[model samples]
Target chain A: MTGPARVPPAAPAASTAPAASTASTAADVDGDVGLHHLRLYVAGQTPKSLAAIANLKKVCEEHLAGRYDIEVIDLMENPKLAAGDQILAIPTLVRRLPAPLKRIIGDLSNTERVLVGLDIRAKAAAP
Target chain B: MPIKPAPFRPSLPKTPTGVAGFDEITMGGLPTGRPSLVCGATGSGKTLFAATFLVNGAVKYGEPGVFMSFEERAEDLAANVASLGYDLEALVAEGRLGIDHVHIARNEIEETGEYDLEGLFVRLGFAVDQIGAKRVVLDTLESLFSSLSDEAVLRAELRRLFSWIKARGLTAIITGEQGEGRFTRHGLEEYVSDCVVLLDNRVQDQVTTRRLRVVKYRGSAHGTNEYPFLINDHGISVLPVTGASLSYSVSDEVMSSGVGGIDAMLGKGGFFRGSSVLLSGLAGTGKTTFAATFADAACTRGERCLFFVFEESAEQICRNARSVGLDLQRHVESGLLRFEAARPSLYGLEMHLARIHRDLDAFRPAVVVVDPISAFRGPDLEVYAALLRMVDLLKSRRITGLFTSLRGDGGLQDAEDQGLSSLMDSWIKLQTVEANGEMNRTLYIIKSRGMSHSNQVREYVMSGTGIGLIEPYIGPGGVLTGSARITQVAREEAMQLHRRQKAERRQQALERRRAALERQIAEMRASLETEEEEAAGWLREEELRELVLKQDREVLASRRSAAE
Candidate 1:
């Protein structure tokens, strides 16, 4: 609004795409960093993906204090939200955060790293 | 000024540069994922710097790298850096890095043919893909220029290579030789590369200085000064001239040099940790003996010591110490001292640096000694560069480094060997000056970087016990070489033996000759007697004949003819 103000053209089809997926996954949401509203876009129930879900639950409880939600959306089951986040790879973590959403692409070995990347924890004091 | 607020976003993680003095100079390392061009004239250390970057990436930073050489063969490159302690072959086996050498033959190939350099691109891309390499080095891009005669195509290909490296988001190092009018081969890699580093190997007053300057590094700050660097077993280390002001207060501890007089020359005690000491002199001046004594002292202080004997074997060093009255055998036996013997040509300069670096890492020595550093000077500028690196590495670790140099005749008479003089924190000269009728052994401290040292040349004597510092002797002559004196003594002894043998041989010869002459005279006398008797007989016969002739001259003549 302040600078060049090059507003991106609205792609309305993407807005309606996530709403339909949310209805089917609504039963699983428990309000754990939007676990109720969360969608984990995974290709299949591969070991990498299972590890990611298990790791997410473990990290959320330890750090997020259960004030959030998570919705595991297997792309093999829905296969539609992949285009919504522009997901090119599998096992991506999408933050339906406090506002402007962010995505992390990897098999999260570093839980603290992933959490820090997702803005879950306070930014580390400048070392 | 008001305190500034911290950024809401987390700061990016920093990566470390794997070079020895380089990281310290830059205060960290080059900007991550940016290509840097290392340019220099022949033997100016461009390739060495690039290799150092790749090696440090793999070994130091725990990041795998790729080294593509279009000039030298991979085996030759490996052999060259083998002395620097970079076991690229082993690193390859461990799958931490990949080294591919592209030999561009000028004779067999035609440059006019349309070539795409796709093979090179594929090879580089494949290497990067295999290792997930964060660093890549192309050594001597100039060779490509000569191999491909099309200058316009070569220039375009070079630009493409640089762009491809950046597009891949890899930190690449492209090395080129500086031409007379060009900063790089293809004459333009410098403009495209994110950073440009120039290594200059120049002789100042007959002594060569290898200086590295960062010409330009885009979008990031860098040290723009020409830093002195050394190439040794450890590879290339740029000695940052910027950090001279970073000093630590000295401790008054009476550190011993192991030699009593040498230690006593210092008003209070001995050299401080990180203080370099130079022991320089001509041959037979007892520099090695002095170094051995220092190693012994460091060992006695309950500190680890590494003695690198370039001129003598470790066993010979132990034996020689006996004559000098300083026994280093006990330290070796106790495992307090580790002695490594090497001829400089045993490896390239970088290889030597690496060897020392690896040993230092293993032994973690508090004090290190390079006996007669001159022995390590190879027929290349790399030797001096390696020595500079060795000095930088030791100084950074706050370890005391002692170097003994066998000064040439001119080196001793002149100010100092320009190659070594500037790098020394403290230079001690052990010269055999001819005063009076004999040569005297004198030790003097020419320069001590951070401490006060003895200004006066101290006369010292070596014997079976140890070094004995003497008061300025007021004798008619000094006899230190023990060469002329020992020779003179040997000659007098030989003369005595010669005189005794000559007298005995003369007596024997005279007796034999006299006996032969007497025997000859006796034989001559015997012959004379026989001849005289014959003559007398003839005379008697003649008288008889005359008497008989009167009686029967005709009958005697007939009888004599018939008898005959």
Candidate 2:
């Protein structure tokens, strides 16, 4: 890739092989200009991973809905991909498009900690 | 060898690294289609070892390799390895080797997103495809740990990298710097790799020694001992110096000792062709001279001789040998003899042995002579065992060995005490005896296995032409020696003269007594004759008197008697 960060044999004229975070790649670049991209890492589709996904969706809808992108990654299919995000715990959520990378642990049950971690502004509370 | 090459392959095949002395320890070489970890402290020569392995693979085994360095650039590594005699530029130009220096500028990037090392894998795969590389080397795995902030990410990537390299069926070496508690800084790659080799640089008593040990080798038998390794222009050479067993075919052919006296002292008038000989002596004895004689004799027989002089220079030994009539210079000039002269303190014992082994391999000499190898005694070496390693190498090659050992006391028992006498096939001892206020050289054979050797201690004499043994001294005081022998001879002469004079005087006395007795007999015979004449005269006078006065009685009686 043209990006000097990539160590490739055939130099690409465009950025390639950059950190392929699932949320960053899936985020709608044109529409979500100011949108925050998020990634949730879990071992498998267990109760914890499913509960984490459901609670994160609920928080996104109640707070900054339609402005954020969330991508869930299962480590069982691709265990090696977890290392790129520094994931040591299962059911960990990472803010992929923020200025400073932030990590939250657990099943996202604590709404207050989750809001503080994701820097979410609640639409109902603000109106 | 793992299972005798059965129909079904039970394990991975070994690909020889071709580094000097390393393949022997690995049985054949590193496991093919597997990733091996090499970890050491800074300046422990890990990169050099890895580079040598790669270069040797390309040059010797015809297996092209890829070197992906994370720390130094391509030019710096190539230059460093080039100084060690590796033609990196040539190999790269020929497309047999690929050097990719991945510059990880830690300050240039901020981690705004997550990513896997798919880019690195792609580049490595391209390089592998470029040269059909069968081997790969990642010289600084620790740099990857520093470049990334997340341990989980780096560890996962490393595991993935090892598995990928294995999947590609290429042998790989990942080198890392040792950390305080972990085998490597990241501490997880060693678990992922199939084998782990640890390099250690230790300074004991101010002498630095590099040692290597294979911590783990999955499904392969390897030497687990801490082998002393030497790094130089020839790369890393590991000497398993103290291994209890080394199997080699032994030669029983006897070889001359060069000097007639020494040969006669040895069993079968010589030593086994490949056996090791130990010559131990005090200072001023004939150890060096005897060793020179052996070298000269070997050279004269048209066999190559490698003389490693730890005490003197080759020229000095040659010049000294001229006094003893050994023409070493001629053999040296004729190319039948080679000399590697250096002080024992010039290098650590490992380097010393490595140099000797390297030279021996290059020269392929039939006879190897180490003059006073005991000089290698220092803080960093177990000199006895180190000497045995040298001997073992020579024996394995079927090369004759002659080693000289210096003893503080002039006794062969010192050699035995040092345990060299037991290892050597023959042990000869030289002595400096202070006989008659002069130091004299005498030699004796302490032991010679499998043949009857001379037990008599022959006094070794150095002449202008050569060295030889003289008949032992004998005197009236038992074997006469030194000044006492001369004095005993003079006393014997004087006593012999006195005895001769006494015998002459007794003969003269007997002659005088015989002459006197003959004179006496002659005088008695003359007296008897004179008495007879007087008797006749008396008789005549008596007759006349008898005729006159006694005529009456004597004459009358004589006449009567006459008448009667």
Number of the top TM-score candidate: 2
Q: How good is the docking of model 2, as DockQ? A: 0.03
* Candidate 1 C-alpha lDDT tens digits along B410-446: 3544434666778787778888777446886877878
RMSD of 1: 26.1
lDDT of 2 by residue, B1-564 (tens): 221232344365777777665666776678888888889999988899889879988888789999988877889999898868888999999988998876554432234233455546756776788799999998886787676675676678778888899899989888989988877887854555578888999886567878888888888777898888877777667775555356988877889998877777766879989888888888778788888999999999999999999989999999999888888999999999999999888777876877887888789999999998778766323775677788888988899999897777754445444577777888888877676787767778888877789887777777886887876665544454445555776888899999999999999999999999999999999999999999999999978875688446865778888887
Q: TM-scores of all models? A: 0.48, 0.71
Q: TM-score of the candidate numbered 1?
A: 0.48
Scored against the true structure, residue B86 in model 1 reaches a CA lDDT of 81
Assign candidate 1 its CAPRI class.
incorrect
Taking the tens digit of each residue's C-alpha lDDT, what string does model 1 give over A1-127? 1112211222232464464455334423633233213445565667767776777677766765444466676665544444445443346566553333555544565775566655565433323
Judge candidate 1 at residue A90 and give its lDDT: 45
- Which digits, one per residue and each the tens of the lDDT, describe model 2 over residues A1-127? 1111212322221222242343344343433223556778776677777888988899878875566667877776655454355454456677654334567656788777677676553322454
Assess each prediction's global lDDT (C-alpha) against the native. Answer: 0.68, 0.76
| Top model number, lDDT | 2
